[model samples]
Target: MTYFNKNMPSGVFKWRGANKWLLMLLLISSNQLIAKDINLATAINLMLKENPSLKIFELRKRSLDGAQYTAGLNPEIEMGLEAENFLGSNPYTAFDQSELTVSVSSVIELGGKKDARKNFASTKYGLLDAQRKINSLDLISELTDSFIDALATQERIKLAEESVRLSEDIYESVKRKAKAGAISDVEVKRSFASLKQAQLTLKGEQSKLERQSVNLSLYWSEKQPQFSHLSGELFDFGVVKEIGQLHQNLEKSILIQALTMNQRLAESTLAVVQAESKADVNWSLGVRRIEESNDAALTAGFSIPLFKRKRNKGDLMEVEAEIDSSRAEQQIALLELYGQVNEFYSLRQAAIEKFNVLENEIIPALTHALELTKEAYLDGRYGYLEYSAARADLIQSKKSLIDTAQSILNYGVQLERITAEPIYNDTAQTQGGDS
Candidate 1:
């Protein structure tokens, strides 16, 4: 289940930034700094080029290549020599009547065992290739989630700055009113406390952003982050397909395809084991010399084991069970994946609904209400309490919008990963050099 995958020779991860692996190599070799903001594509590029786990796939692939090579080989011929009728009874004492023989021998494989071996080896190699790709896709999905988290923190920092400014303006207004005896000292202290809280929140968000940035870089072992920021959109989750259409395409995803490969590999292994059940024919040809007759002749012999199939019953049974297990595992994976797809889809829809309400209705209404309340407070038509409530409502709604957008993006990433549906249309955020 934890099979690792890597970029194939064709570099198929173009969209995931596998094309940038070479560029990453150059930068690392040159000791050049990464000054660009990290994004989805860049993060993938770094993971492909620098992650230790990814490199393991390439090495394992090379080992399977060797297995495929060995599969094509034929049985080796062996030579033997024997002498008889020497140093025995009186008539056959010494070498007086000894018969000498020289022979070349080897097994003649039966039951197409050679071909079965080749097929099994090739299938195993191909299965490894398939697993590598699926693992890569999974890795990219995880990295996307982390990148979105960092981007979300960045958005929150912006919201926090706005909150700080609003808090400062309210505090100044409250002080003016208090100086004129329009409000009590209690209101002044409350406004001052609100300003300090806003500042503290802004500082906390900045620190959170730094930590998230470091987390993103950890995918490639660059724990000390090189990028100043992550450049993906936190609010824009692009378009989502109806769950039905997306689910329909799930079978074609690389993840599901890998299951097919597993089944094929298991079946091929059964073929190899079944072939082994029939022992190969061992035969020999030789030249024999008879001293008594003073003549030479040709001699041949062969060996075939009895009930050879019974010897391999255990192996055949194991392989057959593996095939069945593979089928069951595929069904399990599909079920789990489908469940995840539905869950993420539902979560994404709910988050989107909340975001739209804030973006299109609630936030606008709150902003307008805050403005009116501030004017009323200045004109003595409303109290400082009303103005404070209005201001708090607007700020809280704005922060909620950022949080909800993050949720949408995170859920979108999960959907894209399982469904192979592109939901985060923020690819334009990738930058190579400094940004």
Candidate 2:
């Protein structure tokens, strides 16, 4: 391995600190915005900045850096002095009992091993950074999914309410006709049955909306989670980019990026394991003083390993196997992401097509049919069964439209999460004319 000069930019040292700071700044600024309405992106940015999990990862990255700094420092030098007294006097001559001597000692690295340690530490730091990015991306995906679910639940509630309204209209009409003796008691009972079914459906939808609201409140403010205002009107889908083109741009995909970093980290780890097997030499120097003779002595030492049986034959193989495993996993992750994106795109295409047909053709046709059926019933030509069927058909069609719209929004969210890019040009956009 090669070493980079501390003063120069190196291949392994492209400097992640500057870029990390920019990401931090972006998160911080987003969190500081007024808490009016939290969009999906803003909520994620805020969570990244403030979440405890992300903060822990940030601290872990810093600790690894500290380790690198400590490993890169040169071994320290030391000095000492010693003195002692002789208890007995000499017969022929007098000897100095107390004397002091000073000596200096230093440890010198015997090989280019200090640099190797530094390189290994740097590799560990790089791995920590990669892990941090992975965690951040994961958080983003979860937040997006949760937000979309809340919005979809809100739309479903609106459709349920419309169904209830239709049921109420039928119930009132039948009750009036029964009072005039123009309809049988059984017809009035059927209308009451329909109204009860609709009310039950409305109740179920209301409960779902509340549950979804509670789910969103965990990540966002209470006001933001209560998505009661979303109408069954068409939601803005924003600009539609071709799914094929987006799949081709999978290089920017988040899961792929994480796996790629993991592969590099595994390779780096293998290198570290190999480097560890190399022997290290430690040298030391010291001084010693004799109390009775008033004499001084100096000492120096060095150490070297004589065997590497365990490291070379056992631990090294383990590291090699780990690297191979990591490579395989990385490849697998990439394939899975590719397949998932394609599936989501296909579903999105189908949902969009169905939504279009319903909105542009089926819904309008159903509306006209309902009006004509009402007029026919008033003219006393159509039976109760045909009129009731038309009403139910219209209700079912509106429900289908709402469901398809939700599916489209959900697929859009998945696309954004997988790609790590905004699917829509702006957040305020509705799909087609629905928004």
Candidate 3:
């Protein structure tokens, strides 16, 4: 304390500026570290390979494989040993009182029972496989949705930035005019308010973009989080105009494929029930030894059910009911799919038309109007309020364009998900058919 004088530059004081510079560098590095960057295809691949649900499906497939193997094997193999007093009263003389017998039995299934069982297992396995594919398609759909959300948030963030820049420009203009006595204090105040609002909007959108980026990172490569912005051109909005075979192409939908597979599974189950109604034969074999004899004799036998409870009717009816339910469900899913495709297509079309109008017509007109308003304000032919309103109209037009672009992309993603195809893939042909 005695050495610390007012004129002396202490060690801490000397390093304070360096420490602040280092802190600033650290913050910039931290921001760079947390940014999430992703591309569309890479995101889809991650969802397929890295998702937890896909792992579950793989485990289920392994279990079904085991069951399928077991179904194809023989029913049972039996072995047994027995001890008995073969002689009534004679003991240890010519004939001993004890005897031992061993027996073994193995079942041989007939009447296509084993085949039916194997087929049942195989069908179940096929259903699971189809289920796995459905899972993939579903995951892809979720990825598409997330990807679109990220893109939309990104576009919104850009628009927000633009608004902030425009606001700042307008504010500076008004401030200069006020200093030159060409405008009143009210004009500067209004410009300041608009600038502040723009800044707040930009901050809010940036925060939302950060959240969407975090969500997107879950399905992307590890390096995606470091990306701060998208680098691709925005999707052009328009109809393909090759919509002539729209109804025919509906057959390519993932929802339709899943429904069809489910219906087939129901039909296979009904076949299993019908196969179960038929009688099954059982067979057995055994060997016997007597104390009086030195030889052993083998016996073989087969038996068929003479009569049993006729539960086949109820079982068949149950399977039939399931088939009926599956059919109904399939129909319902088809209807919903059709409705969704139509709805999204309509929305996409409208968004495209609106975006086109804004980009080609509205934006140009707004710019002209804004320029005229600015000139009028310079010549004192317009009030500050009128100039500000015209400027706002231009911003609004740009915002509308951004919103329409986002809407179109959103609908495109939805269509892609429903169809299980790339939205812009022109060469993909439909597969599968009506059952």
Top candidate, metric TM-score = 1
The lDDT for every candidate, in the order shown, is 0.82, 0.69, 0.71
Which candidate tops lDDT? 1
What overall lDDT, based on C-alpha atoms, would model 1 receive against the true structure?
0.82
Per residue, candidate 1 scores C-alpha lDDT tens digits across 1-435 of 322246545444343566467666866855544555657887899898898888888899889889888898899999999999989999987787999999999999988888998998888877787788777778888888778777877888888898889888989998998999888999999989988999999999999988887777888999698778677767656666667877887887777778888899889888988888878899999999999889999999999999989988988889889889989988898888889989988888788778888888999999999888989888989986788888889988988988888787778777877876564333443211101
| Model 3 misplaced regions, further than 4 Å | 1-37, 83-100, 221-224, 238-241, 292-296, 422-435
By summed lDDT, which 10 consecutive residues of candidate 2 come out lowest?
225-234
lDDT of 3 by residue, 355-402 (tens): 777887999999999889888887889887888898789888887877
Ranking by TM-score: 1, 3, 2
How do the predictions measure up, each by TM-score?
A: 0.81, 0.75, 0.80
- Superposition TM-score, candidate 3 onto the true structure: 0.80
Count: clashes, candidate 2: 7
Model 1 poorest ten-residue lDDT run: 426-435
lDDT of 3 at 105: 67
Error of 1 at 183 (Å): 3.7
User: Predicted candidate 1: what Cα RMSD to the true structure?
Assistant: 12.0
- Residue 340, model 3: Cα distance from true site in angstroms: 2.0
Clashes of each: 1, 7, 5
With a 3 Å backbone cut-off (N, CA, C), the pairs that clash in candidate 3 are 35-225, 35-226, 36-224, 36-225, 37-224
